[model samples]
Target: MKHTYAPIGLYSLCKPLLFRIPPEKAHKLSLRALGLAGSLPPARYVLKRFFSPDTQSLSLFGHTFINRIGMAAGYDKNAQALDGLEGMGFGHIEVGTITPKPQKGNPNPRVHRLPQESALVNRLGFPNDGLDIIAKRIESYCNRRNKRYSGPRPILGINIGKNKTTANAQAYLDYKECFTRLKDVADYITINVSSPNTPNLRALQSEEELEKILTPILDIRQKSASHVPILVKLSPNLEHNTRTGMIQKLVEWSVDGVILSNTTKTSHPWEGGKSGAPLHDATLSLIQETRSRFPNLVIIASGGIGLDGDLQTFIEAGADLIQIWTALVYRGPYLLRRL
Candidate 1:
């Protein structure tokens, strides 16, 4: 059996101090500290030995993953804290919903915490550093690791999106550009068609629009990076038929898998895309549904997962992997160690 680390209760203790500040700023501060910690020789050495991630490898999509828990895309939108994230013990880190260009996203107060519900509402959109810079940053990182590393490489998944200003018909090009530009660095790539904050983005999930985005990428795979597996991230709010239709298209396109959610747009009491605890049951159901309909399709469940019970439920419900974001906020860094 794999040895589990003890919770340090660091985030539990510091959260009050962190939460006092705005959510966005607190996130920045945490990212910076994580980067500093990841860069430190002592911190990295100690963490590497302490956690010693179990060699629980999963062979899928032509790659072997040492562990199933991964840090989802949104948290490290710009890929700045990867070293720190790696130090925190995630076996894989999916970075970005990056666009072809840098976007300012929605204005402040975007990330709202609902402590009572254990959720976060955000309309931050895809506010990333754009293709040129991020692609360069990761390409260099991949090159360095490739040159020096020997052990299994953490699965690096790049999630790509179109610029908010980019119109529908042209969005395919944006995704293709990012995929082509970062192909060498990405162990796998995700097509993000479900961010609620991006105007008409979910429309891309529809059969007509989804084909435009997915078809071209596969068209170029043979002449391009043929082996990099591709997956799609779907929205939790999708209707049953819409979900089934999307999966059918993925099967046609030879897409590798699906990440069962990106937050949900709710009403009455909630606003924006609601993530964390509130999204748990819905995500698991989607995973079960998608798995039943398409047995071979790879499913990575994302949403309200934050505990061992939650993880077990997802894994047993046919989830190949489960990704978490909000629980880390509610449960803290110790959550990663515990997993």
Candidate 2:
């Protein structure tokens, strides 16, 4: 595997052009380009070179990451861009809040950019190609590329959730459907109950509700004889005691890890789930609190971390791993280089 490396200066030159397009549209183009480059050694090399590849690999969730930085779930909702994300040298990549069936998510204008705050508000109610489709892609990724790689495999996590129409009474079925499909292929699994876009979805964050959802998925793992790490994604808005209770339950339940947060639901001069620079301080506080309570629990910190220094700050605050979303969109490809 050899590469025709791109000069380090190319990405900065392309930043203005990417920003000119709609943010979502630009995101799509970047995914496609990275997807193509991922299959070709030279192109992948060039792509990684532009980000100034980090040589360190850290172990977590029974797998080793090429670095601590990871791309969060919403970035590649359908599992289509793992190769490309890996090409860019993300230590890990999470795809999907995949549901039992495909959905249109929220209506258009569902995602908006706030350049002034380096933040974004998205009401994309888990729009994805669903479990079956995403599962197949993961299966293909594992069989085709993951098997042959002798080097460190970029950690892969499948993030799962219920559909918008599914009643809360039966949400566990949607989660089970996705978990059963993805468990075999995923290095880790994330139960996403924090997104503000779906009605009543946050209710699942309660300890009783969360246990109802996670216990069954844990059962599936037991039944299948798998030890894949299972993690719960949390909302940043939970009251401190409520959040601590949830972490205690996760520890008691013997779950593998917890994602510090999904996007926030606060009214911060924007609508929908607020992410990016605005989430930095709140996320750190939450991670610190969570780590204090459950010292051994794997904490994947995510939220308002846009600058490179934020990664170190979170890591020092007891986070084992970190994820990024709005930052890539606002800071362009160069941002990850600093990490």
lDDT of each: 0.82, 0.83
Report the alpha-carbon TM-score of model 2 versus the true structure. 0.93
Question: Following a full C-alpha superposition, what root-mean-square deviation does model 1 have from the true structure?
Answer: 3.6
Give one digit per residue, the lDDT tens place, for model 1 in 1-339: 111112246656777787799888988888887777777868866666665445577888988887888899899888887777776667789999889899999888788887777778888989999999998878776776666567776789999999989998899999999988877778899999999898888888888887888777877776773578899998988888988987898888888999988998865364578887777777877888788889998999998887655666898898998887888877777675565
**lDDT per residue as tens, model 2, 1-339:** 111112134555786687688767877887887788778888878867787356578877678888888899899998887877887888889998899999989877677777667778888899998788788888898776756577776789889999999999999999988888888788899999999999999999898998899888888898887788999999998888998888899889989999989998855565689888878887888888788878899999998765657678898899998998887776666677765
lDDT for model 2: 0.83
Candidate 1, TM-score vs. the true structure? 0.94
What's the lDDT for residue 277 in model 2?
A: 81
Off by over 4 Å in 2: 1-12, 266-270
Q: How many backbone clashes does candidate 1 have?
A: 0
Range of the 10 consecutive residues with the lowest summed lDDT in candidate 1: 1-10
Model 1: residues with Cα > 4 Å off, grouped in runs: 1-8, 49-53, 267-270
Cα RMSD for candidates in order: 3.6, 4.9
